[model samples]
Target: NDYGKLGRAGEAIAHSLVSSSAAGRVAYVEPFAPAPGEAQLGARNDRGLLVFSGCGTPPTGQHEVARGVVQVAELNNPVLLNFGVSEVNWWLHYEFAPVCSRTVLVAYDKLAEWDMMAPRKPVLEQVRAQLLASSDTVVGLSEGSIDDVPDASYVGHGVDRHWHDPAIDSLPEPADLAAIPRPRAVYVGALSMRFDVEAVRDLADSGLDVVLVGMAPHPALVELAERHPRIHLIGERPPEQAAAYLLHSDVGIVPHTDEPFTYSMEPHKAYNYAAAGLPTVTLNTAHAPALGPFLNATRDRKEFVDGVRTALAGGRLSPDQVAQARSLSWNRVAEAILRAA
Candidate 1:
C-alpha cells in the first residue's frame, strides 16, 4: 500500500528524502496486490522512478517475479535498497543482494520487543544480524539504537521546516481548536499502546484542554476521551493544519508510555513541536536527554503534570534551542544520506 497521510515515520522519511533530493529516481516495491494492467516486471516514469507493486502475499508465490524486476532495475540504474523494518525479509533481501549498489538498514525500533506475536526470539536475532551484516551502512533513529551495529551513523528524524515553521503566525487557528479553552496541551501522532493514556486522562481530569490530533482512537484512549469532557479528539489533520494547531496551542505533549520501543525512538513530534517553538513536555526516555532544554522530560505522573503546568505558564525555548531544531531539517538529512550513498 502507498504510504498515506498521518502514519509510519519511516515512510514519511522516505517521502521527504525522495521529494527533496535530486537523486535519479526511486523505485518503490511493495508486497501487495498490483493494480490492473500494472507491469509485473518493470515500468518507467518521465518525472522520476517507477513503482512496481503486487509482489504476492507471503506463503504463496511471485517472489521470483519481484526478484527479476529488482535485478533488471539495478542493471539500468543505481539501486539503493533501504530496509526500514527490523525483521529481514529473507527471500527479498537475498534476491536483491547481488544487484543493489548500497544496502541501508534503518533501525527505527527494537525488533524482538516490537513483534510480540512471534514465537521464536532467536530467529529475529539471527535475521537482525544477517540484515546488519549485509548492509553497507546502518542508520539509526537514535544514538542508543546504533550501539550494536558496526559503523552505524546516528541520524535523528527531522521535521519539514517550510511547513512547520514557527514564523507562520499568520495562519488561522484550526476551527475546532479555536473553540477549545486556552492553556491547551496538544498531542500529535498515533494514539497507540505506547501513548500514556492515563497521563492524558490526568491532564484532562485536571481541567486542562487536552487536544489529541492523530489518526484515530486507540480503544483504551477512546474510553478515556469519552469519560472526560475536556479531552478533545480533534482527529487527524494534514501536516500543515497540524502545525497550525501546535503553533497556536499552549503546550505540546509527547505522552508515551515508558517502554523499550520508546527508548530507541526519537519521536518526530518532538522535533515538530520544537520547530513550531512550542513548549514541549515528554515522559523521560533514552532520546529525551538529547533533546536538550527545549523539551521538559518528566520522570513520572507528578512531574508530567507539573511539566505541563510549567509549560502552560508561558515558557519559551532559548535561541540556541530553536537553532538546533532548524538545523535538523529533512533537506539536510536527505543531503547527508545522498552524500553517504
Candidate 2:
C-alpha cells in the first residue's frame, strides 16, 4: 500500500509480483499504523493491483488487522505469501489459510539467531519452525538458511536489472555528494549496529573518506561521524538520489560485521553497487559470495581496508561483473517464488 519506496526485500517482492505478467489481481497489504487521527484503513487500486493500507495499535490491534486480512482472503481466496517472522498479528492470519489457495512463507532473513532480534529468539525460532512445518511451501533466501529449516527450498534474494542501466553511469554527480572528496568509499544503507564501528574507523583512520548514504540515527554511527571529519553522513534519501550517490562513487563498501545473524544475509546494496558499475568491498559473510565478481570479501578490518584500496585502484565493475549483476532481476525471483508455490 505504501507506494513511496520499494527498497526493502519484502516490498520489492510485492512489487515484482504485481509487475509480473503471470500474476493477476495481486493485493499488497501494509500493516503499519497511521498517526493519530489519520485514516485507519486505505485501499488503492492500480489497474489489476489492489493495495490495503492498514492502521491499528499493534498487539492491541493485531486482531483488527488479522480480521481485515481474513476478509481479503475470504473475498479472493488468494495465495497467501507470509513474510511474518516474530509478529503475532501475521501469525493470526495463518488461521485463514484454509480459505486461501496456498500459503508460502519466504524466510528472507535468519530467524532468532540474528543479533538485532536475539531478544525474541525463542519466540521467533518457535514461530518460524511452526510456519516451516505448516506452510504449503517454504522458500529460504540462502542455502545456509535452508539447512537451518527442514523441507525449505532455496530462492535467493534478487535485484532490479533496471539498476544496471548505462544511463546511471552518465548521471551527474549529486550536488551534496560532489562536495565529498574523491576516492569516496560509499556504504548505501541503514547505518546500524550491524556495521563494525572499528572497521569504519579503520577506513577513516587510513585516510579514506567514508560516505554513508542513509539514516545515521544509530548512536555509534552518530558518534563515529562526530569524531571523524573525513566521514560524511548524507542521511536518508529517495531511491533515485541514493542511486546517484552509488553510481557516482569511486568504490562501494559494505563494512558489515561478521556475525551469526548476517550469515544468511546477502546485502542488496552490494548488488546495487555492482549493477551501478562500482567495484565493491564487503565483509565475508556466508552468503556474500553470491553477490558475484564485482565484490571482494574480507575477513578483518585490515583486509577490508586493503580490499577497498584495491577496488579504488581497479576502478568500476567490468562488463562481465555488470552482466552477472544484471542476471539477478526481481522478475526472475518473483517467477521462481510463484513456481515454487
Candidate 3:
C-alpha cells in the first residue's frame, strides 16, 4: 500500500523516497484483517520495510532485526506498530506520536473540522498540541505552513523525477484530447472537496477546453462536468498517461478552494506542471508564492480566470525555473530525512 500501484501523491512520495536508496529495506507491517480486496500480507525488499500497520490484528510473533527506524505519524490514520522488529531507530512525521524518538512532524494541511453540531474541534486541538510538544523537529510543506509551529523548517513536497520526465515517458497527445479545442487547460488530481467547484465551472464556461484527469470525482464535480460540453472528464489515468496530458496541455490549473485545510497544502500538481514546462495558474495558497515566476497564483475568481488566460498567452517557464522544480525531487527529500534521522 505504501508503494502505490495507482497514481496517488502520498503513495508516489513513499515509493520514490524508499526506492531511491539501497541503504534500508521498506516493508509493510500490518496488524489488521484484510477488507476483501485489500492485500493481507506486507511487502519487503532488500533494504527497508513498508508496512500497513493495520489496527486490531495481533502480531505474528516474527522478529526481524531492524538497523534504523523512521516512524511516520500519518495525518489521517493511526500508527499500529505490532511488528516484532528489533533494534530500530524511530523517526516520526506528522500528527500522532506512538513512540516519539527523533520525530519529524509535518504540517501538510490544517487540522480538519467535520461538523459544528457534533464538534471534534477541541479533540483535534489537543492532538495537535500533544504531537507538537512531543516532536523533535517540526517541518512544514510550505513557508506559510510553518506559521503555526515555531522554528519549523520548510521542506516542500517532493516530485517523482522519472514519472514527470518527458524524455523517459513520451508525451503523446491522446487522440481524444487532440480533438478538443486549442488552449487546453488540464487539471490532474482528485476531484474532491479541496477543489474550487465554482472556479472549475467558470473555467468550463469560459469557452476554453477544460480537461480533468484524476479519480474520486465528487458529486458536485461530476454534475459540473456533466453540465459542460467543453469539460472533459477522463478519470484516473496512470502517472505516465496523466503526465502525458499535462505535457501536451497549453496550461495546468490548480483549482483548489480557499479553506482551512488548503491553507497548509503544497499541491504536487504545481511540481508536476513545472516539470512538464507548462504555464500554471493556481489559487493563491500559502505555498504558491515560493514557486517563483513560473506559477501565477490568483487571489480571486476574476484573477483565477485571468491568470489562465494570461498563462495561455505567456510562454512556458524558463530553463532556470524548470531546473529549480527538478531539484525538488523525492531523492533529495529522502536524503534530507535520512540525514536528520
Candidate 4:
C-alpha cells in the first residue's frame, strides 16, 4: 500500500480546495481540461453536495466516486505535442510565486532521482530550471521524493471516499446478464500491453465471455475480439456500470504480465473488484502476495484458466461474500486519509 502518495495528494486537494458542500463532491482532473459543459473545480467551492465535478487521469478508476468525471488531461493535447508535455501540465498541480507563480505541480511517487521513468526528477527539474531561468516566480510542488524539484511541500494524498457505494438502484435486466455466460468475469481498467497474453487466449478458448471493459493493449486483442466472441472487449464503462457488472460477475480477471511496473505497482481494480465481491485472478508474482484474500495467483496459462473455473465452481458470490468486499469501503479510505492529513 506504500500509503500511496498521489492518492493522498489527490484526496488532500479534493478535501482542502473545494468549499464544504462541493469539497468532497467535486472532481480532480489531472492531465485533461474540463469540457465547457462540465463544471470546473475552478467554478465553485462545493465540498460535499454533488460529486459530478472533475478529476483527471486516474491510474485506476477504482476510487469510490465519479470515475467518468475524472480524467487525465494536459493543457496541450499530447498527441499534437508529439507525445511531449508543455508548461501548463506542471502549473495545474499547485499555485506559486510570480515566476513560478500560478503553477503548482503535483506528482505521483518516483522510484529514484536517477530513474528516468519517475516524473519526479525529469518533470520537476525541467519546470524549476525553466522557472528559475525566468527569475520572476518560484516553481514548487507538493510531493515526497527527493528529486531535483528544489522546493516541494509534502502533502497528504487527496482521496474522497465519502461519495462511494450508492445502493444499486435499477438492476441490469436478466436478459442483459443472461448473455454473460458462465465464469462471470469482467475487467474494469485499461487493457494495456501489460496484460497476460496466452492466458487470456486460453480463457477465450474456454468460451468464457471475457467481458473486457477498457482500452485494448494491442490489435491482436482486437483480432481476438473478432475471432473469439468470448473476448468481449467493451471499452471503459462508468464506475457505477462496472461495479454493477462486478456485483454479478463470478471472478475478476487481472491477467497481468510479470513486469517491473506490475511488480512495483498496486492495481486499483484489484481492490474495487474484491470490494465489489469479485475475487481476483492474477499471476503468482511478488505483487500478488499483497492482495491477500482478493487474489488467485497462477503460474501458467492452464492454471490461469483453471483459477477462473475454481472461482466459478466455488459458486456465485454469497451475500456475505459481497459484504466482505464492502468492508474496504471508500469511507474507510476517507477516514484514513483525513487522519493522515
Each model's lDDT comes to: 0.69, 0.73, 0.61, 0.49
> For candidate 2, what is the lDDT?
0.73
| Model 4 residue 283 lDDT score | 62
For TM-score, the strongest prediction is: 2
Clashes of 1: 0
Best by lDDT: 2
**Tens-digit lDDT track for model 1 on 199-232?**
8888887889999999767898888888889998
Per-prediction CA RMSD (Å): 3.8, 3.4, 6.6, 11.0
List, residue by residue over 1-341, the lDDT tens digit for candidate 4.
11123233344344443343322333443343435553333222234322233434323223322223233211121111000123543343222122111233333332233234466656655764554343322211212231344543333221124214365524463345557677667776767666775678888788777877776457777777788767777666655556567666778888877554344334556666766667778763333232466677677778888888887667655566555555554344334333322
Write out the backbone clash pairs for model 2: none
User: Stretches of candidate 4 above 4 Å error?
Assistant: 1-41, 44-166, 174-177, 284-291
Q: List ranges where model 1 is wrong by over 4 Å.
A: 7-9, 12-22, 33-49, 55-79, 88-91, 115-120, 161-168, 288-290, 314-324
Clashing pairs in 1: none
- Per-residue lDDT for 1-341 in model 3, tens only? 23445444444445555575532433343233445453333334423435444323222222211211233322222221111111111222221244323455555554533233126566566666665675666665565556767666666666665644547436578877888887789998878657788898888788888999988988988998888888889888877667778878888898877765565566667888887777788885555554677777777887999889988888777777777777777666555544544
Candidates in descending TM-score order:
2, 1, 3, 4
Candidate 1 or 4, higher lDDT? 1
**Residue 6 lDDT in candidate 1:** 48
Q: Is candidate 3 or candidate 4 better by TM-score?
A: 3
Choose 2 or 4, whichever is better by lDDT.
2
- The candidate, 1 or 3, that scores higher on TM-score is 1
Against the hidden true structure, what lDDT does model 4 obtain? Answer: 0.49
